[model samples]
Target: MAEMIVLKGLIKRFGDLLAVDDISLDVKRGEVLGFLGPNGAGKSTTMKMIAGFLTPTAGTATVCGHEVTEQPVEVKKRIGYLPEGAPTYGDMTPATFLDFIAEIRGFTGTERTKRVDAVVETVDIKEVLCQRIETLSKGFKRRVGLAQSMLHDPEVLILDEPTDGLDPNQKHHVRNLIRDMAANKAIIISTHILEEVEAVCSRAVVIGHGRLLADGTAEDLMARLPYHNAVAVRVTQDNLSIVQEGLSALGPVEAVAEAGGLTRLRVAADDGKARLADVAGLIQDKGLAVREVFVERGRMDDAFRDITKGETMESLHQGDGNA
Candidate 1:
């Protein structure tokens, strides 16, 4: 539960533009922090400052107790960074590229060979080990980049779009690898993919205009959506009104929409909290033959859209957690 990475009022400005407006956050060991934002939202910029790739315009960033600006080399030695696009030396084969990384990380002789072999196997890039990085497919290239970042087995990991070029299976593979490694490391993953937040991250941070908009667990963010835990009842066309009116009587109905010849009803909670069981009784009492009934837990994309549109966290139903 130790804090591995901490940002205190971090700020990054590019000439006239304040790319990363004063923002602060923390990533603790044994936690996977999903860093999310829209394009040009300063996600990559902030991460760069933390990784020592760019100097911050203001504020401070620390990795494992070492200040990024003051002890950049020490910070670099304790963390693994995979930048956006997973850039690598295209001319070198995976074997050579990883070996070079191992050496740079201070591995030597047998230790260097062991680390390279372990990473190559871990990323499952043996098939392309001897292939030039440019000759390898995008997915393979990304795997190579991942291998290099993990070669040193650092305590903190800063991955910017780690699964950018991967397909569904490949993405799943990488996600599983991250989960396996999460117990002992503090990981910061900057990505546009929402599912990755749900899949691997223990907590998510949403930023916009370089300011911290929302910070909490995935469920906390989802609870901001109006449809959080809303139930959907699909009844026959003839019974649409009956179902709608019956459900509305039970609680406030948000909307009733038709799709695929079935009516989907969204019931709302008056106190900004969803009550699922109340709707179930209405369906039974009405004796309406329902084709389908589903409970929506919540959707991250919906919350993201709302947050980025200048909707403050305070505006969301505050009973649900918000930061």
Candidate 2:
């Protein structure tokens, strides 16, 4: 199942508005790809196209060598999709719901019971298995959705906000589940949660304005941060000017927020890799008494905003000009 998921110049439009635009990517088995973007950035729409729920306006998507439009059933059979909101049959219990799903997927007898039990335990939904879905809490409902998605053990998983309603313990459990299954499946998780991408996904694909903005390992995306791997130095208020001036010779120095009798500054690395010893040496060379000096890891939250926000602003400007 290597390269099980592929998208080539995929585009989706709802009338005059373009939802996904010219996005091309491939997901290999053993790779957990984080589908990241702000709301309405077309993450769901693109996933839908690949899942064969929505046909693309142009281009194509394929799952396991089956072009979605040409072989829709083949594609669906290989995919385990948990759409947003985790919609379920309000009248049915989780037990019945999963049984129905197992039957639909052609599992029967002891094998069907075995699969249902496995996913129910995996998702920690034993207590709520017989409760009507509409009567369950949001978290329970979501877990039921997850259980159904995995009951068939599909080769590819397209999870949209899989942990949206779970508590911390449940979230942790599900993250572990995803990691455990990642070795044999091509998984694409669409979530606004940045930490999930770091913890679960092996690589990340960021989309903005319906375009593929960045695609790389989680660390690679974090490197896009302006202060990624920059050195942070804290000096007394009196030494702030002297310290920043000395550090600027090494690279750009970012002025950090001032605090009580102290000022922290970040020395930007010219090549995005700054060492702590470099900053330490500078402080020592000046014989300055600095309270703290350390290297700052790239902040993922800031990087996400910068990537998506910058493109959104740019697109707005372009629209304004056209108008």
Candidate 3:
């Protein structure tokens, strides 16, 4: 796949504070990269630089072979960007707003009309087309913003919280639209919603404290979690200790706790190769009555919290040591 977006040692500063700290990454065509971070973690700042909305304090960003600072117009022409909050003209209707965007993009006459109509249909904003932007619900307003960004049908899409304020069905529709467009475009979506990354992104990038933390496929990131290859063993109280010892004897058992009115024993493997057969065999060997047994799947929410929390704690510890 062709590299559509590239960042080299990207840095952004606000007064003395470094909002983005020497970050570098590549987004390729046919890939939907999820830019993830806690609030104020430089996700928006980096996207702004890439979209040519903010100039970098140091380093550079390029979209579609055009440097952002040097070729802002060219970069803008090839990228569709939905900024945070999806800001729009409160006085203009959705149709008029999209028409204005189409005109700004240099489309005119039948071409401009066609583009505006197509995006309005694609984003499903027809219901609210004539409503004032400020009068529309948050979801409808967001769709209007989306329609504007997609009006040009650019090769790259930079969306910050694209599905914010959207209902479940709307969110699903937007995710599907992103997937459909992923075949030919390089897309970057910044969102705090972990489920969105799992559902739509081909790769996930995590940042915190203005620094890159981790980058990989959703499943790849989840595999870094401690829960990876962990299995939950539930048994009767009479067999709690017996099951714990039985599973522990097989390898290493992580923890034993109470959950869902049963004793839950969590067993883990260093390599994610823990087998259910071995665990069931141990139960049979020990003559223990197993109430329920299942392998724990890695969860995005758990992985996101753990990664960000651990990084924050580690950074604080380092700061204290320096002090």
Candidate 4:
């Protein structure tokens, strides 16, 4: 697939703070790339720069071979942007707002009318097309914003928090719409919702503290973090220490926590393989009646917490040492 958007060492500063620090990315045609980060993690700043809404202090960005700063007008024409808040004219109805946007994009006559009607139908805003924007619900307002963005059928779509404030049905509809549209255009979806990545994106890019942390498929990112296949065992007695000792004899137990009359043991082997059977055998040999046993899969939230916390601790240690 062709590269629709490219950034090299992209940097942006606000006074003494570096909002985006030396980030680089390439978005390909017909791909939906999920942009993820914690709050204030520079995800929005990076999106703004890519959409030609903010100028970078250093480095460069290009959209369809045109420099963002040098040819913003041309770049804007090739991209459809839905900002974070989905701002719109409160006085104009959906149809009128879409018409105004179509005119700004240089559409006229039947072409403008056709495009507007098509998007209104695509986004399912036809029910409230004539209603005043201020009177519409949040979900309907979001649909209006989406209609305007898709009005020109731009090759690149930049959607920031597209499903914010949407009901479950509307969210599902928008997710499906994005998936259907991804076949013909490159999309960069900036959202904190991890489930959205799994639902609609082909790949994901995770950023932290104004820097890129991980970029790959969701499974790839999950594999990079440490995860132990754990076994939750419930014993007849509440002596977790005894169970912990017995489990340790079988293998190197990474962690043992007791909760709800059960000892959850995370065992680690030299090869880091699943040792559930070994764990069960150890419990049986110890004469402990296993009331229940189950394998627990590692969660993405655990990986995210470990990575971000480790980075934060390292930064704090460095600062303390310097002081």
Candidate 5:
């Protein structure tokens, strides 16, 4: 696939703070790449650089082959950006705001009118088109923002927290819009919602503290973390120490907990399918009544927590000169 967006050794700094470290990444044409990171992890900084809103202190970025710094206007022309808060002209109606954006994007005359109307309808904001943006609900306002970003029909879209304040129905609608747009445009969605990543993004890149941590498909990322095939077993019992000890005797157990008359154990092994059967067999042989045994599949949330927690702990230790 062709690369629509590329960052080479990208770096951004604010005095003593390095907002974005040297990072290189690529977004393929017609692909939705989820950019995920904890707060202050440089996700927004990276997106800003890509959108030509901020110049990288060092390194370079390209949008549709145009260097973001050297040809910012050209890059901006080919890309649509929706910032973190989805800011809009509060005083202007959806129709007015979109028309303003269309003018700035160089749309004119009948072309501009048609484009504005198309986007307003595409976002399903017809009823709220004439209402002041401030009067519209958060969800409707977000739709207006989305419509403006897409008015020019840019080939690349950079959306930061696109569904931040949207309701469930609106979120679903926006997700569908993004998926539909991915057929013809390269999109980068920066959000903390793990389920959204799984739902809309074909690939994901995880960042932490101004550095890239992991990049791959959801399944691939889950496999990279330890305990990918582990399973959690819960048994109804007052005391889990004995049960934990018994389970540990079989193989390596990751965790054990007992609360509210339920004992939970996480077992780790090379073959999860076989390990589950072994565990059940052992529990039966030991004459313990097993309440439930189920495989626990690794989720994106678990992987994100592990990566960010490790990064946080490492950063603290580094500051303390411990590592």
Candidate 6:
């Protein structure tokens, strides 16, 4: 896949505060990059520069090989941007708003109508098409914002909190649309939502204090958790003590509460590697009758917090796959 979005040494400053500091990243076609950071972490600042809405204090932003500063109009033509809050003309109805956007994108006559209709259906905003944007529910307003972003079918999409106000169904629909579009476009979505990244993003980037802190696939990030590939064993209460004692030789054992006449024990890998087979073999040798065993994928929520809150990535490596 071609690299469609690139930022090098990107910096943003307001008065004495540096909003984005020496950040850099690239998004390739067929990839959805989750741009994540805590509140006031400069995620949106970096995005605004990439989308040509804010000029960088230093460094360069590029889209489709066009430098954002040198070729703002060309860059805009190739990107679809959904800003924070999904701002729109509150007085305009969805129908008029989409049509107006289509016209602005150079569509005409039947082509314009098709674009408008396609996005309305894509976002499932048909029912609210005739209502004013401000008058619609928050979810409906968000859908309208989404419809406008994709109205021109731009090759790159920069969505800030794409599912911000969406309900479950709307979020699912938008995420599915993002996945479907990933094969053809390079997408950068700024969101603090962890599951959203896991669901649609092929790569995840973490920023904190206005600096690029981590970047990798979601699995890579998760692998840094203490129990990334840890083993889980479920057995009858009778075997619980034996299993716990035996597993302790391999790594720390955390026992979960008993349920349904069974006790669950989780064993973290000492070497930060998947050791399920090693554990299973131990059970086999001991003639232990275990109910079930599985490898854990680790906790994403913990990983996200560790990655974004910490000052340095090296100190937070619970495993080797640090971004």
Clashing pairs counted in every model: 0, 0, 0, 0, 0, 0
- Give the residue spans of candidate 5 off by over 4 A: 238-250, 269-288, 311-323
Question: What TM-score does candidate 5 get on C-alpha atoms?
Answer: 0.85
Cα displacement (Å) at residue 49, model 4: 1.3
Show the colliding residue pairs in model 3.
Answer: none
Candidate 5 yields a Cα-based lDDT of: 0.83
User: Using TM-score as the measure, which candidate wins?
Assistant: 1
The sequence of per-residue lDDT tens digits that candidate 5 reaches over residues 1-323 is 39999899999999999999998988888899998889999999999999999999999999899999999999999999998788899999998899999999999999999999899888899998889999988888888888888899899999998998999888888999999999889999999999899889998887888987777776666665456667667866653666677788777665555666676788875643437777888787876655677866667787788777774334333332211
Q: Per-residue alpha-carbon lDDT of model 6 for 174-293, expressed as tens digits?
A: 999999999999999988888999999999888888977778888878877777888999988888888888877776889986768888888887577778888988888877778899
Q: What is the lDDT of candidate 6?
A: 0.88
Runs in model 6 with CA error above 4 Å? 234-240, 249-251, 255-264, 270-272, 281-292, 316-323
lDDT of 1 at 74: 100
lDDT score of residue 82 within candidate 4: 94
Looking at candidate 5, the ten consecutive residues that score lowest on lDDT are 314-323
Off by over 4 Å in 1: 270-274, 312-322
**Candidate 3 structure lDDT:** 0.87
TM-score of each: 0.95, 0.90, 0.91, 0.81, 0.85, 0.89
> Candidates 1 and 5: which is better by lDDT?
1
Ranking by TM-score: 1, 3, 2, 6, 5, 4
lDDT of 4 at 54: 96
Give the residue spans of candidate 4 off by over 4 A: 228-250, 253-297, 310-323
lDDT of 3 by residue, 15-76 (tens): 99999999998999999999888999999999999999999999989899999999999999
